[model samples]
Target: MTVGFVMLCHTALDRAAQVARHWATHGCPVVVHVDKRVKRKGYDRLVQALGDLGNVRFSGRHACEWGTWGIVAATQEASSIMLREFPQVRHVYLASGSCLPLRPVAELVRYLDARPRVDFIESVTTEDVGWTIGGLNLERFTMRFPFSWRKHRRLFDGYVKLQRRIGLKRRIPAGIVPHLGSQWWCLTRQTLSAILDNPERAEIDRYFRRVWIPDESYFQTLVRQVSDQVESRSLTLSKFDFQGKPHIFYDDHLQILRRSDCFVARKIWPHADRLYASFLSDDPSAQATAEPNPGKIDRLFARAVERRTKGRAGLYMQSRHPNENWENGRTAAPYSVFEGFSDLFENFETWLGKATGTRVHGHLFAPDRVQFAGGDSVYNGALCDSAAMRDYNPKSFLTSLIWNTRGERQCFQFGPGDSQKLIYFMAADANAQISVISGAWAIPLFHSNRNFGDIRREAAQLQKIEAEFLTVLRASWVKARVRTWTLAEFIENPMEPLQTIVDEISPRSLRRLSEAPRLADLTGFGQFLQNLRNQGMQPVLMGDFPATGAMPQPGNRRGRPYLVK
Candidate 1:
């Protein structure tokens, strides 16, 4: 019953008083860890509002640097101070100033009560994504500044950019795949005690000191390593954009905030009037069910698995495809592999365009085409191939497409399935004996603002990709490839706006012909027969979408069985 909140503050002084006030009524003790670099100008008002609540407040300021270990130092200070003061507190909920409690305070307590042994921490011992515990750990442990460090963050960002281009870790150490996830976590007293008493405290600190953004990984990592069962997901509410920056909250995100079932959200801007107003205790039922908006936070988490119409997988790894093509019918050699999410594709396509000297048409499929008909956010990232299934496993996203001769996509769609039949219609053997296809490559991803950079640059990349695509199209094997489906008829459903990219970007390839029940036809392109075409594009990467119509419900996993002939 000794549950307390460890509030980490950067700015947003106005909400502190409100958050403190809410927690006080819930009878949960509070501890504040304000960033030292920033001032506590608003504390006077916040204190006055609290009016002498027993909650304790500490005054050590934490100056957190981007992608650095200062974050770990700050959290360690907070935890130590809290433990010293509240020896009786069992669970310390780590949160930020911007995050607000979405659920009634009581419901959160009950949820914790049901689970006493498990740590809400997420720690993976592997040296892969989480670099803190990896072989090249020392390069980071030493206080060696490889890149030029500058006060101006953008310049520092420039340095980071340089490192990325040259195969170096800007903030994260070299060769160490840093484990990343939500910075906020809820930990038990036992776990906290173990972390404080860790025998390798000095050694651990040595590494974290150099590691970037250690705050997000430190406590969670330590707790995860010690705890038997650490939940991979966090119970907080916060969303980061494509560049890993937290997305500012606006009224538009209200639907996500309302429907999201989380305990808290963080890194909110100072002036989120609508967001603050929405949290007011207006409705009684809203108190109990309303917690962290699961919807808002869902955007930050990436899916790890992909299952299709006939999925049968346990441990899945990405299979790198060949950068060439295979022979087919009338078409040149059919493309043996798709350049998925790779900058190399940009180079290849551009080279091919130059080689073949024609607008090289290409296609990239969706990882889970059926799942993200409306948008990527609509995806649940999990699928069940059978209707009677009990537990539907989570999966990554997949996409598909048909492109014009310019290496630009004409239409795109997604559906889920497994590796077995993924390349059945037209697939080449890739590593792990899997058939990988291009999903969502012909759309925003290939030429978007975030990862792809300036639109003009993206266009240049597209031109290059076309050049590389020529090599595929000219191959004798690819000439035999057939048409899978008409672009217009392929993605007419409201669910898949991703396919709309095709309608807008590649108009020349498909036309709504003036023939019969449906005008969508490929009669103009008489080269390939429909019989030899792939039934549909396959999702080689993320989640596998079930063909026809199938999806996993929110918090529930079930789907119609794949009709196997």
Candidate 2:
């Protein structure tokens, strides 16, 4: 006995006609049900294309809408016609117009003939299914969904919520249990007839007419009641994304489709000339007698879904810009942010680049212009030094910098004088290593030849901004590695902190820091703080700086490091 095909065609009628003719010419009867939504001209053209084939026939048309009962009605009409007209057909394979036969038709016939009693349909209990998206699992059966989810989304959502609020549920038919799976299936003639001709079919049909996406569950659920031997899997290879949208096969997927060893694959691009020409050819390699195994390409599709959803870290694209905190990572790689370092040390960027052997950049968020290393107008990733563009989306700028310079480690300075927009974003990123010398902003203000009144006002502003930033770093939710020291404390022991920062950045290097960055002359800098305090603005973040501004000495290293012996 030969296998028959029942196809549901909507758009792309020409391609549908081609596939139907291929099946009919191969001695397999093809019964097709076209979506009534197709215009008459397109329908007539499809009919004319396949008119010469005697085995090809058309069933009654149905207005098939996705996520509705119309598709199931179309499939039922086509399958009934296949069983009635083609008496020689033993197995019926339900497919879509876009489905292409991957293996030779004769091979599929031989394979089905081996398991004549077994029905191949992906049937699984709702509780066992975890792949369902859109929050509908058992609710798909229990709750009545009269509104079309796609066409009338608001009404559909409102109805669902209304039903949920009232705790309304429908009782499933007594004899049958609801199951869900892929819409495509290949079933035995006996099983198909039993489901189509069941005495309570009208009642079951009425109940499922209001069911959400009955096309996927009607046959899948009913076959369990009638069929004794069920394989519980589809012979067709179809895959969906995390969003429940089917993955369309194109010319690039020819090798991938061949690797699946599936009997038929659906959702082929109509214009993929290469895929159509290659798969539809009479090549001997297409006649392999291997068992259908879709798992061979499961890993590939999983990665595709991951790439679409989570995406590559720090790489933002128009196709997917995930909501905040939903990204795979905030930045591509680990980098260092020096808060107040540049303000306290002269030529700090150059000193850091030499000491750590990594790219060191000047204040990236400076208001005037991005002070890139060596004062270049453009930097890596073609990023410009325009402060306006950088300020527009500071998060993207920083992420782009890290992503573009992935292999090489990056270090940049930050201060309250620069843009503070990325404060929260950097604080939440685990890749950020922020070493802060608090109250160091005062050092630049002290050195600046400005009016004392203006210095006092600016100091108050900078101190407030840095204090707020430090609060974020100390917050429990912060993911960045943060080390904060008062300006006075840092100068007292600069080597230890410098060594620690360098070790973390270049873990492979064992060399200790031999020389430190030149500290800016701090003569009377403490007096500057004292003067600010006298002016009624307490220099709290600076710790207790002495009036003389001399670097505080360690208290003689606890009795001059005497030997215990």
Candidate 3:
């Protein structure tokens, strides 16, 4: 039996064929199942977009309604069609339209050819790894979904009310042995054939009939009960959103996606076209990252300020008289010095919103700043009135980054081989909020060199983003609240390097330890500090200068935009 690609897309008719084309070009048979809910005309257009595919065939239509039995009907229909039309088709890979092929199809075929006996589906019944959001949903299971009542709106409403009354709510009931995992699966031909031919199949189908959102759980549960060879992990990268939406909208949470290194990430928005294109391209360096290219970020900086000031200049124009006599520094000092506590609080609050990730409530003089220096003042010039900022409530100072009650003593510091590198969070805002932040809820740039901020160009890119954010502030006259330690401050009030830094004090702190965690690790505080002192960054290297036989200067073209891969 040969491995075949099976695409099960609900409404994305036009997009399915993109993946089909990828598979078909490699001589792999493609089985497409367009949702029956889609219009025939749209389906026809999808077929037309497919162009000529000698090996690919549409696996009939399926009307896959969410939280309904229609999805099961579609999957079964597609599977049956696949078996009848292509008897030689072996393993069926369940994929969706949003999926993109990163590894070549030939590579996939090669991988499967190398592994014949093992099924790639993850079905371990682990409590922590992946479990159905189960509880009393089983009552929805006890009765086989009766199609006759599906259209009976009154009956459905009553059924839900009764379920809730009987304590049969949504939680997965104790010891129900609930199974769950990614809907996508790669099943062996023999297993799939057995499932198809089994006489007990009707019983299995009936059980799944009443299952809530059976599409996701049916195959996962059935596969778990059917085989022990199932791996405990799915190869597909499907994002589950908070509202039960199938797609992830990564406008603000783009950082989260970057952290999840699944081979493929998806359901990207159309607005992210540049990033989508570059990511799917054959080259990664040229990827349209959200990084602030000085040129690109600069353009946005100007445009943003323009929009803020557009048609609104009148609001500020009347404030000052153009020919008014200007005050000397002595006359201006009174206003600056006599500014009320309320004004100072307002200024801190504004900066807090822009930079700090901590929330401050009910307090005027709550000292929100934490200085990790000798006496204080990273920059003495900026500390003119900061002397009074000492003796702050420590609790208020240690609450950002979800570190409330964790105590400042419990707060750990890290260095990533550069004096300036320690200032990464400042780029996002003021104070590497993740590192130096104790209070004020806000996202500071380069928060920490720990698990966040990469030493790669990403760090530089983050700086660019924060710089861009700052430029916006400067244009709007928003004062930055946090200031860095000055050379004098470091000399007069230098604090000991954090223990995390001490652990890595060896290696003469000269050579870069591979990646991080070691004293020589670029991530270590000492190493990061050293890098800043030496004016070095995480080394970016060029790979594989394609031999002249293949191409000219191969590595150079691919070098500059250091791809994560």
TM-score of each: 0.48, 0.93, 0.46
1 against 2, candidate with superior TM-score: 2
Give a tens-digit lDDT track for model 1, residues 1-565.
7678877776766687678668766778777767666755665565566667876665476776555665667777778777777777678788777777667777888788877765675444334443232223323323333332335656655655665577664343333344555677888888887888888787776767655456655775666557776776678766654344575666565556667777676655567777667665745576446434465445334421112211222222233112122211112112323233122123333333333332322222423323222233221224322222211211221211211111432122212221212333232211111111223233333233354234334334443443343333334443223222112222233122212222233345453322112212223211111111232322222233333323322333322111111
Q: Model 3 RMSD to the real structure?
A: 24.8
RMSDs, each prediction?
Answer: 21.2, 3.9, 24.8
- Name model 2 segments beyond 4 Å from true: 319-323, 448-453, 548-550, 555-565
Which residue ranges in model 1 land beyond 4 Å of their true spot? 40-51, 125-179, 287-565
Residue-wise lDDT of candidate 2 within 1-565, one digit each (tens)? 9999999998888888878887888899999888999999999999989889999889999999998999999988889999998999999999999999888888888899899999999999999998888989889999999898888999999999999999999998898788998999999999999999998999999999999999889999999999999898888999998988899999999889999999899899999888777777778575466889999999999999889888898787666564656788889999999998988899998988888798799999999999888889999999999999998888889999999999999899999898889998998998999988889999888889999999999999999999999888888888888888888778877888888889988899888988889999988888888899899998899877887766566453321111111
User: Ten-residue segment with the worst summed lDDT in candidate 1?
Assistant: 428-437
Which candidate order results from sorting by TM-score in descending order?
Answer: 2, 1, 3
lDDT of 2 at 62: 90
Give lDDT tens digits, candidate 3, residues 21-88: 76677666777778887778888887887758777777667567666777667777667666777777
lDDT of 2 at 308: 85
Could you tell which candidate, 1 or 3, scores higher by lDDT? 1
